[model samples]
Target: MELPHSTAPAADRPSVAHHRPGRARRTRPDHAAPRARRPLSAKVRRYLWYTAAAVGIYGASLAYAHLEEASHQAVQATNAAH
Candidate 1:
């Protein structure tokens, strides 16, 4: 069975508009100016570094505690077997 095709011309038919090859459509208009971002101050940067360091330390301590508990359990298992 053959599908019936529209006899209307290509321009007259309702179709989705295609973007040009290798060009992306912009979300914002070209005439709109972008907002300027402020740079972080020295004190704010220091605080961020301190917070990151504290988080890393806390994660390391938790990992160490888990490993310690695993080792303690293994020792107890060995003693029970003996």
Candidate 2:
């Protein structure tokens, strides 16, 4: 009896030339600015949004750190006073 074939057929292999044919096509309009030349208003809005987010995060972190430091200091003072 013949053993069963374990290898794939010749047609199942991929050719090197066919690698990512769809990547060459441009999905965006060519007439539009390339993200860097956007209007100053748009840039300002984006910057403000980012700045607001950063400030919010920083404020939250500062508040948490201050609260933690105050709590630690209070505990230390109470322990020392005992």
Candidates in order, TM-scores: namely: 0.57, 0.43
- Cα deviation of 65, candidate 2, in Å: 1.3
Q: What does candidate 1's lDDT look like per residue over 1-82, in tens digits? A: 6545655567867566555634546455665787788999999999999999999999999999999999999999999999
Model 2 spans > 4 angstroms off = 1-40
Best by lDDT: 1
Q: In TM-score terms, which candidate is top?
A: 1
lDDT of 2 by residue, 28-60 (tens): 667565667655798899999999999999999
Pairs of residues clashing in candidate 2? none
Candidate 1: segments with Cα more than 4 A from true spot: 1-34
Q: Which 10 consecutive residues of model 2 have the lowest summed lDDT?
A: 1-10
